[model samples]
Target chain A: MQLALGPLLYCWPREQVLSFYEQAAGWPVEIVYLGEVVCSKRRVLSLDEWLDLAKHLESAGKQVVLSTLTLLEAGSELGALRRLCRNGHFDVEANDMAAVNILAAAGVEFIGGPTLNIYNPRTLAVLVGQGLRRWVLPFELSHPAASELINAAPASCTCEVFAWGRLPLSWSARCYTARAENRAKDQCEIICRNDPDGRLVSTREGQPFLTINGVQMQSALTQDLAPWIPEMEAAGIQVLRLSPQYSGMDEVVECFDRLRRDPGDQEVLRRLQSLAAVGVCDGYWHGEAGFANTANGLQQS
Target chain B: MQRMKLVCPAGNLPSLRAAVDGGADAVYLGFRDATNARHFAGLNFSRDSIQQGVQYAHGHGCKVFVAINTYPQPQGWTQWQRAVDEAADLGADALILADTGLLDYATRRWPDVARHLSVQASATNPEALSFYHRLFDIRRAVLPRVLSLRQVARLIEHSPVPVEVFGFGSLCVMAEGRCLLSSYVTGRSPNTYGACSPASHVRWEETDQGLESRLNEVLIDRYGPGEQAGYPTICKGRFRVGEHVYYAMEEPTSLNTLDILPELMRAGVAAIKVEGRQRSPAYVAQVTAVMRAAIDACLADPQAYKPHAAWQQALASVSEGTQTTLGAYHRPWL
Candidate 1:
């Protein structure tokens, strides 16, 4: 299976974003998803800058898709979606129906992003009628469920699973990051950039529960589904998506790339566990609580 | 301007009858199975009750809408299809659906039957509303509980289909259709199992900290003795962010738009929905009656509409946390 670099979900400096992709062009991944998928206030790089990055990635033999925001509330955000639809070159990953509507109207074959909520083959077929070429399995699907949907999917469509990073579990219009700092979404400064990975939220007993990264609520534990690489390959999975975190992402991608080739690399999974700042989990793949890791006989801690 | 329709919930036959008698223009309910959200035991309607509920509602000039809104899993696709077909055969007024495939089936099988997009569809913008309207010929769309009042007004003006906004009920801080926080903690979710924080996994224990509610051993909240406790919804739980411990996602509050009835009327909203299908018959009656009176008062004189003191008091008695906010509507952001 080929590895695809998912979008940079966090807000970083423009220079860091540019340089990350410049370095990412040399990574072992074949496909790269660019642009922000979480908040609209973050525009470190404009559409042209994203296109420029796309061109840069393409020149380095990477297929690029511009990912749109999962939630769109304002007309300005809609305008940006319209611009992404007419970007003229790179395909769009339609995060919401608003993006899908615009992309379908533009008559472009686009990838259905994880947030589209395609669970069954019929939903997949409905989108395929509107030119859906590839679809990302939503983060909540279990391994068996994912297999069922993937088996029934049209052969022309490439199925990609979110194989790494903190799983985004919830989203809201009121920014939890701003709220954590006692700030309003309209007047507060962009303090969400402070937590490069994401601000951790734990239960009152101090057990990790979730991560507040701007509007999106992610799992405090990073999900490492690399242990399922061989099974996914046998299940006809063509692509594995690795969401870019703030640190150790290159090595994470390399590990997934190398592990796909050599399934017996027991040390690779251990190294990946060391790389995750908040630990690892594959409970969603096991059809259990998403925060617990039971795969590969790992402890729940 | 025409008075907006007030839609309310009905968990069982008593609630269905209560909503009709309490002056609901429409009462939406779900099947007994997992095909709908609120799949709690002793809640929802059976096929026989659906028939009776529709007759009772139609007899009272109140519409009956059967909700088959949960995303149909691959294994249970036929169950959702059966729900739609049963709702159609039972002579319901509309089918509230969220899954695209179910909508496709309903569109093909019952083209003449009215289709209303469930809030679980999370169609916040006009483009999405148009997508449902064009694709499924949906008669109306329920807006997710995330848009500000101004955003709602602008969207209603441009939407191809009529718009419905929540009037009063439990608040969802996050988008309804996309959130997986419940399934993250419990194996069941609104999208898949039609239940958020399913009670089968909930456990309330007396601990040293206090009376604590846990979902599958995950701490939800701790309350002092005799203090009011909320349902174990993960979103409203107290959690620590950095140095502070509080309701990091949302407080245990209900969304009440009683203060903004006139503004909603001015916005030309087609309907006002109350957001509890798991509540009791008394709750359905009280909320439906208060909302009916409020809508009538607003329509009688938009310039001089006010939520009555008794109305607010009665609502607060049955509210989630004895607190209410014009959530997302008034932009209670700061």
Candidate 2:
């Protein structure tokens, strides 16, 4: 199975984003998803800049796919989606159905992001008919469910699973980050840049429960599926998607790369656990609570 | 302007009858399983009950809609398929579906039956709405509670199909189908299990600190003395972010669009949906009655339309937190 870098879901400085891609060009991953899948207001990297980065990554032997936003409420966001669909040079990962509609109508083959909510074989078949080439499995799917969907998928459609990173739990119109800072979504300055990894939201009992990205709520636990590589491979998962984090992404990619080459490496799993910024969880894979760390046999803290 | 249809929720046979008798133009319900979003214990309709409910609604000159909205697992796709077939056989007016797979199945098998895109589909844009309409031949699409009035107006102007907006309901702070907060905490979610923050996993503990509401052992919120504690939906819970503790997403409040009844009607909204399927028959009757009156008043005199004070009081009495907001309809909320 090949490792694919999922879209960057957090806001970062333009320089940091550029340098991260520059460094990622040489990483062990074969495919890189470049674009903002979170808040559309995060315009640190414009479409032209994203296209430029996509070109640079292509030159470095990495297949780049531009991702559309998960939620679209404004015409400006739809306009951006139109541009992304018609970029012409690179494949677009359609996160919402708006992107799917635009790309399918344009007769462009696109990758289906996890948020598209494809579960049954018929949905997969329909999208495949609409020119879907690859589909990222929704994060909440259990191992057996993912395997079933992948096995039932059309022959031409590849299946990718979210293998690493904090699970993006939900998206909202209200920017939780801005709300936390006591500002309206429109009037608030782009304050999400202050949190490269997203701000942690802890329970009243002081246990980390979720992470507040601009408009998205993510799990506090970083999901590590490295321990289940063999199961994923056996299930015919073609690609493993590792979402970009603030730091140590290269090391994370390297660990996954090594595990892809050699599936039975316990040391690599340990290294991945150490590289995680939060506690590791594999519960959703086991049909358990998403925050539960089934690999470690521990309840969610 | 068309008289806005008042769609009411029916969790059971009684609720379905109540909605139909309480002046609902239409009543939407679900089967007693995970095929629909309100799969709670002692809630939802049995196969026989759905038939009876449909008959009652049809007898009362009201339409009946069956919501088969949850994303079906690959192995359990047949259950959802059976639901569509049953809804059609029961002579339901429409089938509210979210999964594209089920939409495909329903349209292919029962082409004559009307299909309305459930809000759980999260098709917030005209492009998405047009795509579903073109592909599945959906008659109408429910707008997610995340769009502002201006956005709704634009979408209505551009949409290829008719649009329905939520009028009164408990607010989901996040997009409906995409939220995994329930699954993250309790392993069952609205998308998969058709329930959010399932009561089986919830615990209310009285402690020295306060009355703590926990969902699957995670403290959602702690209420102080005399503080009105709402149900522990993870989104409305207070959480500590950095040095501050507050409702990071939103406070526990219901959505009441009574004041904007005229605006919505002027924007060409076809229907107003009241969203409490798990509520009691009384709750369904009250909400459906208020919304029915409000829509009629707004459509009767669009220029001089004003919300009734009694309607607000009736809705607030049944609201989760005894308060209401326009939710995403107001730009400031976003």
Candidate 3:
């Protein structure tokens, strides 16, 4: 139905961060989730600057939502969450239950992020009671599982799916990006910016495995649902989230937008197959091993 | 004053008995299903075994907590719900749960049963911990092993429920309860399917460099000649950046908290957990007894408790890679 650009998980310089959103304003996307969702130590732009960018995105006819940190560690982190709740500029995507409480206490309506792990319909109803307007399905939910949950979704809530980009698998308090740079977590000088697409971690045999974006680790394979748009529609998916990567991001948005405009576009699907960085994987959607790819119609759905 | 509780893991009946005999105030375990987080072959309790184990623990003045922690699938919710009802009916001391929805269900369904929040919930701070109190009425919170002693103390000062911290065992580098790395590489997550670095995905190879440990055909870590190799979990593997390769996630080691008993006691941690459910009964007996003695000595004289060298020696005999550290307790950034 609609496309949502997920918040930038990787750290970028201030100019790069500003420039990226400036370009993103023109993309054919409905919702744009901004702010840092990975490590809180990465602060290339101040809170004020993020708000300014949110205002700019809103001006460009895109719905804006601010995202809080996935893992809250210290007092400073909680304080930032409070500020975001009280900012009153745009809605917030509550990544953790702590943020959910903060937003509920502040009397702010928010979108429930994927990390909240709302698996069942009753949980969705409860969150909706707490002023949750939208819910993003966690990456591990297969098509059959998501369809069951979506069928039971409350009429008041909208359901979104993580349809593209590397699946965010986990988050840690300890920064792996900092550790990889041979620096301590506290004193590490902004090392995550060194790799825009995240540091590609491979197996010993040179197979692409995972990408590390600060404390958050993601699958190396980009999840492409172009071939399953009909299935997603049947499952009542309202929005498809595309995560921000370093290169060919605009082309990614365009390819998906073209498919959205005209469903069953084989050329676009074939184009998506060739454009992904680490190739495409849809196995988790089929309830198989996450790395198992059944792209050639050889496996049963 | 009530002595702090020592909760230990028991994957099987033998370890359950060993834990109780070694002075564990309570032994926690899961049934043989996805409802439990440690669903390995030949491990965890069956429904019958849990009833027997609870009876055994209760007879010894010890408690048993059933861990029905993983999230319930759509069609699979009935199975997990049955575990909660059965664990409660079997007279378990408490139920350790992680999913918020499941916690809510258990609290409403079995109001009289004591409920503890599993570490997989990742409720690290006072604000997060308070959510369980306000909603599900969780009696205690098993904290993730990522907090520093000072942070833990601050949280204890604010928590309405009892706090439990890891005393010794395999320290998860990633945040507990939230990790999907294993599921991303394989298909099962500790939260969704009750497995991580699952045995089925593991493979060991004799490489030219040394021993290579892999998970799902992916090289997690490589050991040099004479260097001990640890099990391959993606987070604890060695990797390279700019031609400099090393242990990117963590050095091959386990957690040792015998030296930090004083700090944990001073911080008012209600329970100290030892985390190896897959370990041998001998390892459980030896580790639990050593910790029990250490806690007693610390209570008698906080400054006078000198951990015996033999305990550390015994610990090293069953360690993951023959090296251990006070993981995240002393060094929050390591």
Candidate 4:
């Protein structure tokens, strides 16, 4: 029944990232994940700077977790990850297995990021043995699928589900944002900064399909599982993670906060749908196409 | 240095025989169920057929690797476990696994059998390989397609186990295990269903614009009449981004590492892999034969090895794209 803010996936300006965290200090969420989880090229917030923000957020009475990059390519990125794992102040969310290995070797208890792909209990159990404290259910897991794994997971290990935001569907070595601009990954300007929430990629028929943010591809529509709040509770999900979007992030957090207090809050759901980047989808939860959303009465289009 | 092992993929018994007869040091295949990554209709081996394949490969002094790479779900957990037992019983030389839990089970029950990490695990760096090696005692690890040549060389230098890199096949622009673009459109992903852009959901429609490929009613791409269309996966398809329509992710192509075989061999890669288990026996035979020659040429004279034009032409004819690139192996590919 607790709310947590997931890592920021976009490449925002330094001032915007700082101001967002400063405002987040007063938000109702108890836990906040901060760091660059998309492209390692995003250095708007350095590890030292992220640690400074973590210290400030900790003072603001919030538990902080440092998130690692989803795709680790260069040795320099590995060096950055080594620093994150050895931060010693806050727990780290291991996004890739290299981070997991470093944290486990250091004997540091860490949160498993969604990209770790903890699909089965044995995977969770193996991670639990290797110092996994909690795990974020991967974005693709359906409601029943999540429940099965959560049930089979060790009793002490907690489960967190991505409650609201654009679903991060895939990661590639090639940067689509750069490719879309007809630029090479090297020698190209950091053009991703131009689109804060990611550039929208639509079908040839002009239907929104996905959003490209550097190497990550996300669903064009927002995924809101607030309508299934009761089901998550019934399945013993300890926390619901709300990913940080450029706009309306605080409102998304507030709506979830209100809905948790009153599961039947109809007005809150209506406002949440309006906040959808294009439309709302909870289809992955329904065991249907990830872009389909019908159970919550949210329009798929 | 020892000659690098050449691993070829086989979907059926015929493909397995083709790989072995075509000079594959090891032939990797999956059961005809969801236990492996390449779960497709009329593909993969049944228990009896795999037993026959093992006998054939073993008799030919070749190794057979059984792939149980997909993450096992709650409902199908026991099925995956049983597949591990079956592959072991069939005398598989190694088990190419991606799931940690399944690796845990296989490690505990059949500690003697060699376990190779499947590329579906997407363990890109040296530390990740170390983790898998430390935990599962995996003997070999197939590197994901996302690493550069320098990255792959650096990893091999520090890896606890021998490393395998893809030599030729249809290219995967994304990290293998982590991508879910297929599930978003078709509701079946590589991790969950062992199929990306499952053929069941694919539909080809001819419209005014030309031929269009749709997955679960979502238009993936449109092809001109003379355009040689490849497979209908989301990443390789053309889409619109800010008034532009093109292959924003990746073009349909193959990862031809023949040009860089000497570099990979010199870097101490343990094996060269040909990735196309879902393809035909002919595709397997052609790739295995060409790669066998390429690896041998590189090993014979690392300083003077040059990829022959004939080898390139032979590979291009069977490639998914008209041409091939070194893929993420080259620094500029990223």
Candidate 5:
């Protein structure tokens, strides 16, 4: 199985993003997904800048893929998607249907992003007919569902699973970060940069509930599937996608690399748990509530 | 001026009759299973009820659209396929679908049956709409409730087929078919089970401070004394972010596009959808009546169109939070 760095879902400073990629070039990850999949207003790195970074990562022996916006609202967003699809250098990860349509119309082979919602084999076959080369499984799919989908999927289409990072639970037109700051989406300042990883939203009882990253709502707990590598392999998943966090990503990459080399390493799992922003969860993989930490044998329904 | 079609929801036989009698040009419903987005207990239709609904609607010069919008799991495609075949056998006017596989199956197996893309497909742009229309030969596509008026107009100009927009009812702040927040808190979701924030997992507790609404043990909101409580959808819940506690996503409210009927007419929207199937027959009747009046008045005289105060009052009585906004149609809401 190959480790692929998923796109950065948070807003970061330009220098930090560049330096992170430069550092990531030396990591054990074979594939790197560059570009923003969250809010389109996050222009700290322009499309050209992302393409330039992709070139840098490619020279460092990393297979690069440009990820498209998850929600395309405006003509400008669709225009950006068209450019990404026609970039002609890196393969594009089609996150939304618009991206899929554009890529298919352009006769470009693309990787289906998790948000594309390919749940059944028939949807997979339709996408495969439209030149889909690889598909990242949606975060909510359980072990049995993923296994069934992989087994039924067209042989040419590869499967990737989100193995690490906070699960992106949902996306909305209303920007939660801007709303939290008491500003409308249009008139708001770029305040999401304040919380590089994303602002934590806690329940009234003060439990870590969710994270607000601009328009995207993510789980407070990072989904760690490292312990389930064998299960994923058994399910016929070829690529493990690790979403980039603001910190401790190198350690995360190394831990997954070490796990693939030595399957039953308790020390590596412990180190991975320590680096998670809000501990770890593997419940969705086990068909339980996504917030439940099934790895510790605690199954809360 | 073309009289815009008023599509309303019918959760049961009574609601189906009520919608047709209350001036609905058409009524959309789902079978009583995971095949539809409103898969609630004691709600939706059985095969007998759907056959009766089709006869009743057709008698009243109204059309019946069956919504089989949920994405089917790999092992469960047969259930959805059976639903499409049954709806077709029942002589329904159209099949409202979201899944590409279901659409493919429906179009191939029942070529003469009309197909409408459900809002759950989340096809916001003309390109996405074009793709669905080209592949499945869909007659109409329901626009997701996330587009601004101008964006809707632009899409209409480029669309390959006629479009439908949500005219009123409970608002989903997140894009439909894409949100997993419900499953994150509970085990059920709209995509997988056709229900979001399922009532089976909900608990209402009365505490010393207030009435708390919890979904799967996560406190969605706490209502103070005399505070009107809406349904505890996770998006409308209050949460603490940094030093402040507020409706971090959206406040409990409904979407009312009564005031924008003229603009929607100008945008060439073919149909206006009223969105509440998990409601009472009375709720369906009242909403369909007001929306019918509003649409007729707007189409009759676009220049002098004005939303009646009585119509607004009638809708507010049934609206959650006792208030309504234009939602994403208004630019500031975005």
Candidate 6:
């Protein structure tokens, strides 16, 4: 399976974002989705800078796609979506229907972003009719469902699953990350950049649970399907997306590279355990609750 | 001016029946499955109940809108699609939709069915509204709570479809259709699973620090004996930013737009929506009845009608408690 690097969900300094992409140039991933998928207030990297980086990544042999804001609030966000549709240099990942309509009206072939919520073969066919080239499975869809959908994708569509990283479960217009810092969204001061892996939320019992990433909420556990490589391949998944985290992504990519090289390697899970953050879950893949980890050889009770 | 329709939520058959009987002009509900946004257990309608509900609402001269609003997963589109087909077959007046693919499917599969855009679509502008209207032939759009009155006015001016505004319910401080906070913590999203701050992920503890509310093993809120605790979500929880610990995302507020009824009506809004789908049947009946009377009184005489103190008190009793904001309708920045 090919590796696809997802758009950076967390807000980062412009320098940090540039440096992250700079390092990603040499990573084994084949596709890199650039642009903000969360809040639009963040001006870490302007559209021009993102396009410039897209060129660099493309030159380094990676296919690039510009992602639209998951939540389009005002006229300005719609204008940005229009610009992304007109960018011309790379494919667009339509996160919302407005983006899809923008792309379809312009006759731009786009990847159906995970947030598009494609649930069955018929919806896939509908999007494909509307010019869908590739589609990412929503975070909550199980592996069996994904397998069925992948097998059912139209001839022209590529099926990619968010195989690794903390699943981005939702996006909102309200800035939770800023709220976590006791600030209004307008005066958030880009405080979300401080928590690179997202601010971890713990239960009263000190159980690691969720993470706050600005307007987006994610799982505290980095979901990994490294051990499920055999099943994914068997299921006909073309690409496995690994979302960028705050740190240790290079090591994470390297670990995935090794697994791709030897899909049958029994010790991949043991090696991955040392590298992944706190918890590992592939429950959504197994058609169970998302937190259930099928990799540990233990079925969820 | 004609009285705007008061569309209220009915999580289950009892709430559905209560909302219709409680004087709602129309009651909107979803099936027990994932097709609707309120997918909490013991909530939402079953197939037989939905059919019965349509008949009951029609008998009462009330309309029924089935919310097949959740985003359909690629592998699970069958349930959502079938729900829409069944809703159409059952003679439901409308279907509240969010996903583009599903919207396209509903429009193509059931051209005769009326389509109301769910808040989950987050279509806040004229262009977005027009796009949905042109593509899906959507008759109405539920304005996201993030819009101010001016924005809503502008939208109504340019929108090809009629606008529906949230008059009351749980105020999603964050934009609806876009928030993933609940899914991040509980592994269930309102967009994907029709659940927000699901109960399975929530737990409260009384400790030396006071009452702590937790989700997915994370301490999202800590309440002193007197301080009211909001629902648990990473953003809604009290956290330290530099030196301040407060409700960062939202301070647990319910939207009470009763006072602003005149403003929304003046803005040419076509309908007023109330937001509780997971609340009790009694809560639905009380809120709907109060709002129905409040709207009627306002339309009959805006100059003499004061925001009912009793309505406010009853709403407060069922609300999240401690905090209430007009939400984005009055906000300069939402």
Each candidate's fnat, in order? 0.71, 0.89, 0.52, 0.81, 0.73, 0.41
- The residue-by-residue lDDT of candidate 3 on B1-334, one tens digit each, is 3567899989999999999999999999999978988888888988899988998999999999999989887888888889999999999889999887788788899999999999988887787887778888999999988887788888898888899999888878788877888887788889788989889889998977789888888788888887766778777787654455677677767888888888888888999999999888998998899889888988899888888898889887777787888877776555
Interface RMSD of 6: 3.4
lDDT of 4 by residue, A221-257 (tens): 8888998999999998999999888999889888999
Candidate achieving higher DockQ, 3 or 6: 3
Range of the 10 consecutive residues with the lowest summed lDDT in candidate 6 chain A: A292-301
Minimal lDDT window, size 10, model 5 chain B: B1-10
Give me candidate 1's TM-score against the actual structure. Answer: 0.98
Candidate 3 residue A200 Cα shift, in angstroms, is 1.2
Best by DockQ: 2
Model 5 docking category: medium
CA lDDT, candidate 3, residue A293? 77
DockQ of 1: 0.77
The sequence of per-residue lDDT tens digits that candidate 5 reaches over residues A1-301 is 9999999989888899989999999999999999989888988888888998999999999999999998878888888889888998799999987888888888999999998899898998889989899999988989999999888887888999999999999887889888888888897678898888999999888989999999999999999988899999988999999999999999999999999988678888888888998778888899888887878842221
The parts of candidate 2 lying over 4 Å away from their true place are A297-301
Candidate 3, A183-291: lDDT as tens digits: 7877778788888988887765577778878888888888877778888888889899988887788888898899887867777777777777878788788887676
Model 4 bad stretches (over 4 Å): A296-301
Model 6 Cα lDDT, one tens digit per residue, B241-300: 334455545667788888888778888888999999888999999899899999998788
- Per-residue lDDT of candidate 1, residues B234-324 (tens digit): 9999988888988998889998889999999899999999988899999998998899999999888989998899999999999999999
Please give, for every candidate in the order listed, the TM-score of chain B alone compared with the true chain B: 0.98, 0.98, 0.96, 0.98, 0.99, 0.95
Residue A150 CA displacement from its true place in model 4, Å:
2.2
**iRMSD for every model:** 1.1, 0.9, 1.8, 1.0, 1.0, 3.4
Off by over 4 Å in 5: A297-301
- How much is the lDDT of residue B331 in candidate 1? 76
What are the clash counts of all predictions, listed in order?
A: 0, 0, 1, 0, 0, 23
Tell me how each candidate scores on DockQ against the true complex. Answer: 0.77, 0.86, 0.58, 0.82, 0.78, 0.32
Q: Model 2 residue A81 lDDT?
A: 91
User: What's model 4's TM-score?
Assistant: 0.98
* Comparing 1 and 5 on lDDT, the stronger one: 5
